[model samples]
Target: MAFKLPVHCPSCETMLSVSQLSCPECSTVVSGNYDLPLFLQLTRDEQDFIMQFILNSGSLKEMAAQMGNSYPTVRNKLDDIIGKINQLKNKNGKDDD
Candidate 1:
């Protein structure tokens, strides 16, 4: 079964950073205050939507058909995701400066 990674604290809803990662086979480990990737920073539902959109080959019309939503609805969803991605990029850019 596929598992979803936690991106925030359940109690306080604060964003989380990775402190450690380990390999199950070799037992190798790495530790640090790692920032989450841009995609992983989105909510689970958003991630799922993105996956579906990708699987549909980035065609909004195809995604609308698969999702049983209207074309405009799918377009709006894409626009929303794009906005959030831009916001994340801008935030990271500011942090890097």
Candidate 2:
């Protein structure tokens, strides 16, 4: 067996594959070439929420419907995910500089 990184879902604690773009349960991107943290930092629900948000083109209404959640809830989750991405970007930028 090939060596695999020990990545797990932050929410459900599910094992994640390094080649997976999104978590099987949460739909969060777990692996990539980008110099950033793993997606497992976020909960499975958060990961799933983000994947749906992106797929819906950042439409909260669509995400809410897909997730069976209220619009505000979906929006809040998106905001949180975006904030994390921003933080990662800032950190990476600082590292490069």
Candidate 3:
């Protein structure tokens, strides 16, 4: 079974960096320090919500039905995720600058 990728350090709670990657087909390995994509840094629930939203064709009503939540609740959840993505983007932009 595949394990979830951890996004933070256990002790310090700092964001974790990807340092190595290996190919399953060939035994080739690549090593480098890298930050995960903004999306991957989000909580798993957040990721799943985004996935479900896409699967529902970006329909908030459909997502609400699928999740057994009110439409406003689903909209709030989506809005929260959008805010998080924007924050991450801004942080990355500053880091780049």
Assess every candidate by TM-score: 0.86, 0.48, 0.90
Worst lDDT 10-window in candidate 2 = 32-41
For candidate 2, list the clashing residue pairs, or say none.
23-28
The 10 consecutive residues of candidate 3 with the worst lDDT sum are: 88-97
Cα lDDT tens digits, model 3, 55-91, are: 8899999889878999999999999999888888887
Candidate 2 lDDT score at position 93: 64
- RMSD of model 3, in Å? 2.5
Clashes of each: 0, 1, 0
User: Could you give candidate 1's per-residue lDDT for residues 1-97 as a string of tens digits?
Assistant: 9887888899999878889999999999999998788889987888999999888888989988888999999899889998988898797774331
lDDT of 2: 0.65
Residue 90 alpha-carbon offset, candidate 3, angstroms: 1.2
Candidate 1 TM-score over all chains jointly: 0.86
Q: Which stretches of candidate 1 lie over 4 Å from their true place?
A: 1-3, 94-97
Tens-digit lDDT string for candidate 2 (1-97) = 8763455657897544445467679777755544325465455676777677678887889878877999888777777887876675575565331
lDDT head-to-head 1 vs 3, winner? 3
lDDT of each: 0.87, 0.65, 0.90
